[model samples]
Target chain A: MADTEKKKVIKPIKNFSMEEYISSGHRACQGCAEVLAVRHVLKAIGPDMIMAMATGCMEIISSPYPLTSWNIPWIHVAFENAAAVASGVESGLKALRRKGRIPNKDVTIVAMGGDGGTTDIGFQALSGMIERGHKVIYVCVDNEAYMNTGIQRSSSTPIGATTTTSPTGKLEPEGKSTWKKDMVAIAAAHGIPYTATACPTFFTDLQKKIQKAKEVNGPSYIHILSVCPTGWRVPPNKAIEYGQLAVDTGVFPLYEVENGAWKLNRKPKELKPVSDYFKGQGRYRHLDERFTQQIQDKVTERWNKLVELCSEKPEK
Target chain B: MTKPMEQISWQEIEAGGVITEPGNASCYHTGTWRSQKPKYDENACIRCWRCYVMCPDAVISPDLEKNIFVWNYDYCKGCGICAYECPAKAIVMEED
Candidate 1:
C-alpha cells in the first residue's frame, strides 16, 4: 500500500482581534481602497503607534475639523512633510526617552500619504528620512493618481490612462504619455532595511509585509496599490477584483527588497493579459488596441526585469 | 475668499490641532449613505466567513451564540464587497 500523503494545513492567525481602529462615521468613499489599506495597516501595528499623515485623501476624509476616525494618535502635516514629521517624532521620542520624559519607547512611528504626495511632492523629504536611518515606516498608498484632487495625473500614474490633467483628446490620444514611476526601486536604492509592495486584495500578504516593516530596526518603505473606484473608472464593487487583477496581470507585482535582497512574493501561475486588468477601468477605456499592446509590452518588459532582479544574488 | 485676520474675532476663529472630545465620530450615523443592503442567508452559509473577513467597513461580526455572521448596517456604505467576496454565496446585495 502507498504511504498516506499528509496535507499541510494553513491556519489563520490565532486570537486575531477584529477590533476596529478606524471606526465608522468617517467620510471615506463607499469603495475607498486607500482607507481600507489604512485600516488593515493600523490593525497590524495595533494601538501602540503614532501616525504622521500627509495631506491627501486619507487625511481629508478622516480628519475633518472636530471629527476624526483614527483611534490612534495621529498628526496631520503638510502634503510633502509626513516623512519629515515622522523623522522628527522618532528623534524627539528618542530624546525624551533618554531624558526619562517617557516611560516606554516601544511605540511604532508611521508616515502615510497618497501617490502624489509620495512619488512627487514628498519625494525629497522621504529620501532624507530614509537616508537619515530613522526608525519609521513610510507607507505610500498608491492609487495611481491624485484621486483626492479631482483625479489629476501624478508621477505614479501609468501610461495610457486618462486623468483630468492627462485627458485623452485628438491631440493626445494615449492620455498619460509617461510610464509609472518606479517607487519601489527608488526606496530600494535608498538601501533601506525593508521595502515592499502590497495590495489590499491580498490581505495576509499585506498584513505580513506591514508586520515585517514594523519589526525592522531602521527605515522601511511600503508601497500599497490602493484601488480607486471613482478615479480608476471602475464600479465600486470591482475594487478588490481590480486589485487582484493588477497582481495577476503583472501590472503591480507583489515583492519585497529586504537588506538589498529581492524576493517575489506572488508569482502568478499563468500571467493574465494586461487587457483583463485594463478593460474594467474607465480610465483605460479610451485606449486603442495598439496602445493597449504597447502598454502590455511595457508591463512584460518590467516584469521580466523584476524577475531577473529577484533571481540575482545580492551584493555583499 | 481669504478673510482678514483683523476682521475675524477670536471667538469666531476656529482652533487648530485640538480635539476636546476624541472618537466622537461614532455619534454620527452614516447609514443614510447606503443605497443597498446586504442580506445574509443562514442556511447557505458554510461558516467560511469570507464576507466577515473582507468587509472594508468592518461592519460584519460573527455571532458566536447564533453560530453565524451579522452585518451592522448602521455604518455599512453598501460597497457590495461582502456580497462580491462571499465564497458560499450566502450574502446578497438588495436595494434598501
Candidate 2:
C-alpha cells in the first residue's frame, strides 16, 4: 500500500483543460487509439496551427462530407501527398507574409497520416519534404496496419501479425513475415532536428513530443504507436492496455533522436515478456510457441541494440 | 448521422475541411455509442489519477475543489479503460 501511495505521488495528474480542438462525434470506433492520439496531438499543438491530413482513418473519420470534427484549418489530399501539400502550404504562407498579404506567418504547419500513408505510399513525398527543409511537423500514427482500408498489411506492420494482405491460413502460418520499418531512424537519417516515437498510453510524453516538434525550426517527425482494437482482435477497452504492454515489453520503446543523439525516455526496470503483449491480441493467435519464442528473441535483440545506441556518443 | 444535404447552402460549406468556426463538432453528441458507463466511487478511490492518463476520450476532468474526478458523459464512449486501469479500484463499469 505504501509503494502504491508512492506511485500515486510520483505521477501527479495535472488537470489539462477540457477545451478540445478535435470535437466529439466523428466516425471513430469506440476505442480508437489513433483518434485519441490525434486529439492529444491537437491539444499540444494548439488552435493556432493548420494541418494537412492524408486520405486515411483520421481524414475519413474527422471530415466526412458536410460534418467535420476538426476545429482547426484542416486540408485533406490524396494518401501519398500530405507532406507535399504541407510543404506547399508552408511556402504559400511564407509567400503571403513576404507580400504583406498576411500580417504574420505564425501558424504551425502539420502533416498527419497513418503508417500506410507515411511508410509505404507517401514515403517519397515525406523524404522530399525532409530533404527540402520544410518547417513542418509530420505525424505518423502507426497502428501497424492499414486499418482504415480493412486491415491490409503495410510496411510498418510488425512481423507475425495476421492481416488481410498477410493472411495466416493453411499455407501461411506466421502471417506477416517481415519486421516493422523503422521510420524514426529513417527520419533521423535525413539530419532532421527532431524525430521521436510516442504512444497513446503515455499521454504526457506524447503531448510533449508534439510540442517539441512544433517548436523545432526545420522538419520534425513524431511516430506514434496507435493501437487498433478492430484490426488487432483485442477488446475495444483493451486499446490503452495494449499500448502500455507494447512499451513495457520493449517492443515499441519510447525515445527520441534530437540532432542524431538517441535518448531512451522510459526504460522499464524489468522488461515484460513479449508473449504477454501478444497473447491478448487475436492477430497473433495462430502463432505457434516456437514462432513466439523467435519474436521474443528478436524483440530482446532490438532492445539491446537500441540500448547500445543510446549509450554511445552521438556522431558529429 | 444523416443531415439534410439539400438544406445546406453552397456558401455555408468551406472549400476544404478548414473549420472557420472553432469547436463546432461539440454539437454532435457521440456518447450514445456507449454500452457500459464508468461509475466513480470516491470512497474507494485513493486519488492515484491513473484513470486520467489512460482514458482515450479525455473525458476525465479533475475537480481539485471537490477532490474528485469528473466524467464528461457527453463525449465519453465508456470504453472502461479508466475503470480497468484504476490502481485504486475506484472506477467500475456499469450498464449504461
Candidate 3:
C-alpha cells in the first residue's frame, strides 16, 4: 500500500445511487420504448414517489402474481384511470398530511399510462387533473396502441398505421385512417404549468424535461413517444431506432411548451426522408407511393408550424 | 454489425458519465436498472431539503451540521420530487 506505485485513477464518473429500484425481471417485449422511458423517468424522479399505472403493457408486465419488477411503491388500478388514481393519491395524501396522520409532502404522486389511456378513455380524468392544479406529474408513454389489450387501435394511433384492429389487407391499403389526436396540445390548453413531448430513445432529453416538469407549481404533463417493436412489427433491437426516426422524419417534434412558449430541441442539419423512416416498419407496408408522399407532405406542414412556434418565443 | 447483448457494454446503452482517452464514454446503462441523477445549484439553495426528504430512494444526504443536501443517485429513481419540491429551484435532474 505504498504511494506512487501507479495509483490507478478510477476516473470519477457521474455519481448515481447504488440502490436498484426497478429490479431485473420483467417481460417487456424487446425494444419496448415504454419500458425504457419509464425507467428514465423513475430515475429522474428519485425514489420517494408513488406511481399509478394504467392497465397497459407496463402494469401487466411489472405486476404478475407476487413478482413485481418495480422496487418502489407502484400501483395499477384500471385501464383509462391512471390519472384518476394519481389524482386520488395526491388529494388523499394532502388530506392525510394536513391531519398530521401520515408523512407530510414526503411523497410525489405520478400517473403513467399509454396513449390509449391518456388520450382516449382517460382523457376526461387527465383533463380534470390538469385543470384542478393538483401537485402531480402525469407521463403519457404513448406506444400508440393498447398493447396490453392485444394491440388494438387507440385515438392517438397515427393515420395509415396498422394495429390489431386496423390490420391492412387487399381491401384496405393502409390500416388506420384517422390522424393522431394532439394530446400535448390538449394538456397545454388546460393551462397546466408545464407540458412537453419526449422520446424514450433520447433519455437525456427526456430526463431534462422531467426535471423541468418537477419545478412547475401546479400540474405537469409529459407526452413521450415510446416505440413498440411488437406492435410496430419491427425487430426487437429497433425500438430506439423508431423513436429516432419519429423525431428525425418530423413525425414527432421534440419540443417543450413552457408558459405557452414552444422550444424545439433538435433540428435536423440534413433532414432524412420521411419514407426512410416509414418503409422500415411493417405497418406502413400497404401504403402505396401516392399515399406515402401525401403523409410526408402532412408531416412537413406540421414541422413547419412547430418551427414557427419555436421562433415566436421572445428572446431570453 | 449485430453483436450479442452480453458482448456489448451495457454502458453503451447509457453511461451516466464517463472519461475515456479514445473518446469513449462510460454508459450509465439503463440495461440493468432505471437510473435518476440529481443536479443542484448551491448558490440558490437555501439548504432546505424538501428534495432530500421527499426522495423515495433516500439517495440524497446532507450533513445536518452543515445543512447542505448532496445527491447520491445510485438509488434515485429520477422521479424529480427534489427538483419539484425545492422552493428555491435548486435541485435539477441529470439524465443517467
lDDT of each: 0.86, 0.86, 0.73
Task: Looking only at chain A, give the TM-score of model 3 against the true structure.
Answer: 0.92
lDDT of 1 by residue, A125-216 (tens): 99999999999999999999888879999999999989999999999999999989999999999889999999988878888999999999
lDDT string, candidate 1, B3-30, tens digits: 3224445575357756545455665566
Q: Mark the regions of model 2 whose C-alpha exceeds 4 Å error after superposition.
A: A1-18, B1-20, B47-49, B62-67
Candidate closer to the true structure by DockQ (higher is better), 1 or 2:
2
As for candidate 2, its clashing pairs are none
Candidate 2 residue-wise lDDT, A177-223, digit = tens: 98999999999999999999999889889998988998899999999
Worst 10 residues of 1 chain A by lDDT: A1-10
**DockQ of candidate 3?**
0.02
lDDT at residue A182 of model 1 (Cα atoms): 93
Candidate 3 chain A weakest lDDT stretch, 10 residues: A4-13
Writing each residue's lDDT as its tens digit, candidate 3 over A101-148 gives 996656767898888778888889888888888888999999888888
